[model samples]
Target: MAVTATLTSTERQIGIAISAGLAILGLAMAAVAKTGPMALHGGMALVLGIALVFYLGGALYDHPEPTNRRHAEYYDAPTRFGIVMTLIWAVAGMGVGVWLAALMYWPEATPAVPWTSYGRLRPVHTSGVIFGFGGNALIATSFYVLQRTSRTRLADAVSPWFVLIGFNLFCLWAATGYVMGQTQSKEYAEPEWYADLWLVLVWVTYFVVYIRTLARRAEPHIYVANWYYMAFILVVAMLHIVNNLALPVTWGAGESFTIWSGVQDAMIQWWYGHNAVAFFLTAGFLGMLYYFLPVRAQRPIWSYRLSILSFWGIVFFYMWAGSHHLHYTALPYWVQTLGMTFSVMLLVPSWASAGNAIATLNGAWDKVRDDATLRFMFVAAVFYGLSTFEGSFLAIRPINSLSHFTDWTVGHVHSGTLGWVAMIVFGAIYSLVPKLWGRDDMAWPKAVEWHFWLAIAGTLIYVVSLWNAGITQGLMWRAYDEGGALSYSFIESVEAMLPYYAARTLGGGLFLAGAFLCTVNCRATMRAAGDRVDEADRPLATQPAE
Candidate 1:
């Protein structure tokens, strides 16, 4: 029989009643739909919040009273679920990303329909990476990191599954809503309020689970990486809630409008925007760096103090850097200047992190040649270093003037996304899958080698074409004849980009093809492992009689 212990009658009763109550609330709200999108969204949030309360109540009751083995098993189900989902979604999310990149080069590639347009696909791409890709990594890694760092299992399995499965379902809703032309149009907070509220409930439970697990920790000193991870999760939840304040169209229906308008909206959006990068992309990944670098290289972190300093520095400076996105716009000039200055200041902490990762690998150069996983991460750190420096440069007012709305911005984002974020995800997945599956044999080892080279080539071709195209477009837009008339028509710039666009399409195609191979290899590896480790990978039931 299966070891199903986490779920009790009282919990189930509570969950049912709660779901009914939320259903009633949602119907009542939808009945009064004329109130406006914001009101509708608020009403929907109320429903989701209530349903989550029900689930939590049940989860609490169903959880087994602690036994030594039971306590250790508390974390296994959720962690394994999250690990599996991360591997699966990493491929799915990246596939969407590859599609989105190609569309940039071929505007006509996406049909002119509302759902298929650039606006919608752009959010789909962003949501997939940030939420589908990055979000799952955080979930899977945090569970693993927390267990190892705290020297304890998760607080409870039931709630953790709710958090992982629940969060991914929310990602599904948001991505589909976008492709279906449902959105709130806020940068990084594009999910309509209804969707956003679902995330909030899932995340709060995530926080609770994390804290409860910490309470059970065997270790006295919390690992530094966990500190960074916790802050990222907590802060991003706050940022997501505050910045996504909105009006909704209906409950269970995804539609909403952000509260902020004009300059204020721009400020709020980017404030959340930059920090999403700071905390979500950078900080969480830093935790990965700490664990993987040390574990892979067989060395301690370079300096604990440097990690602390960099963490606080990035947090303090980055919140103010979003206004740099609004430079030369209606956002207050002083705010823009502050953002620019802070962006420069932000570089120190960012580099401090980069320096730490690179330094951790200092004496392990020989290891880099044979280990593909370490190679991916080592190169990712180098790209992270380069991208941060480039970010600070572009945040400058003059540079922003040249780069804004051009392909240069596109190139920059891909450098960080494909070059940094995706590389780390690749490494983390490689690290997680084997251990979780307990298989010595990877389905196809050489396929991994081929996949890595293909990704590198794709990323290079994709970014370089955009860079060349961006500079050309930026220059052409500014040029004028001596007669004070236009030197080139808008169509002229479009015509000039055809060759570069074709090159970009080819690059993105290669990336997509490689992702397909990865998915196949992963599936085959799972099949090869079969049931042997599925049982072993779980928590043990009893101690041996000694």
Candidate 2:
């Protein structure tokens, strides 16, 4: 084993023991749980808490033992988890989204099934995409980015594993909870009190690990990537806690109720709901795009100043835009106006980053053409620009009047999710796999190009169909006679949407096909990777500053 700056065997053993202990407690609690999920959750907390204690025990006592030898320890494990999970969660999350898409056009698609109903499955789809798929992408890339940018391995051995395993466990509970009809009923803040507590435990440790790693950085300036990542970590922790404010039914196990009531609750919920996208999805992914896109393609960023301008601008503007969802409802006019204004203004900052990314490909046109990874990043920038513009357009009062509560909103989201976020994640995984797996290149480069085409074609079909469907549905609903009476019945509006609905289904089906391709591509790659690695084959990740 190579000597880390602070590696020690005793510390590792203690950490491992603690993790094992907590895991045992969680299993026991889950196995013996009562009715609701809360009992099972406290049991989970016990496990997480003990694991944390053990991990920290190692980090604190496992100092490098005053050894005189200095050596490099390649970070193969971190990247492996990161890359593998990006693909795994992508398939799972996107699968949920496509299923939800089918449910939209077919009311009986759920067939009164409690677990599969729209109300329940909505959270499943949202969390799967946001937390499961997006969350995995964030953790995987953040680990890779922080290590490279800080010029250090993660702060400790057990801690990184704890972060990954603990986070995935949280995701599993979230998806399962949504299906089992357990939710706080707060939009984007649906996970119940226990899930909230679980996230708190996970997020706090994530922030600590981040800080500890940064504290021991070997670089002159903390890379902008790390700054974006840290901001995301800090803000999301605060946002998640504030929004998940529910009074639990009991310490044992049961339902919970929100402290906020009526309009006050509405305001608070949307504030948390929308910002989840801003900080959790946008900020973290932007960090990935900033570091991985350029680094993978062997190009420098277009403009550092532009990046800072956009990053700060997004941070300030996006916090208030969530209320736009509440337009023309219980929210005050000024609140709606402020929400709409900020969302519209969000366009500038969003475009700035998009522009900066696209410009970075200045001399790398050949790479963009030949490299599947670069293609993923390049198209991601394009979609980022498209999604931002569409978002701003949808937030406008005239457009919201038509598209609010329609399939248009869904279409707009997928533009961001499938087009922008998923594409970038695909690029990151392609770049990270070889780096992590200790191979010279992808197990099959051509398959990645195939994955890219499948995703793009599917996305175009999906987004375009919904755009058409949303406008048609919106106009049909508001059709009026000269006497200001309804010209079209609600069912008529539904009827007009049939062809579009079928098209949307087709488009979503195509997206799923591409995702399935990715799953196969990733599985084959993993199988090729045996149990152990040859350290000499590691990629050039940490290099001297240019």
TM-score per candidate, chains pooled: 0.86, 0.89
Candidate 2: the clashing residue pairs are none
Q: Give the alpha carbon lDDT tens digit for every residue of 170-268 in model 1.
A: 777677767766677777777776667778988999999888777767778888888888888898997898799887644434566677888898888
lDDT score at residue 291, model 1, on the 0-100 scale: 81
Q: Please, what are the lDDT tens digits per residue for candidate 2 over residues 1-546?
A: 222224455545656575666666566556556555655564665667575665556465546562322124444465566556656776777777778777767867677667878787777777877887788778777877887777666665556666777777777777777777777777777777766776788899889988987776767788888878888899999988887788877655546888888987898888887887788878888998999888877988999989999989999999889889888998899999999999999999999999999999999999899888889999999999999999998988888999998889989988998899889888888776765655556677788888899889988988988888888888888889999998999888787788877777777777778777877877777667543444553223333111
Error of 2 at 124 (Å): 1.7
Which 10-residue window in model 1 sums to the lowest lDDT? Answer: 537-546
For all candidates in order, the CA lDDT equals 0.75, 0.77
Candidate maximizing lDDT: 2
Q: How close is candidate 2 to the true structure, as a TM-score?
A: 0.89
User: Among these predicted structures, which one has the highest TM-score?
Assistant: 2
The TM-score obtained by model 1 is 0.86
Question: For model 1, how big is the CA root-mean-square deviation?
Answer: 5.0
How many clashing residue pairs are found in candidate 2?
Answer: 0
Report lDDT (Cα) of residue 303, candidate 1: 85
At residue 410, give the lDDT of candidate 1: 82
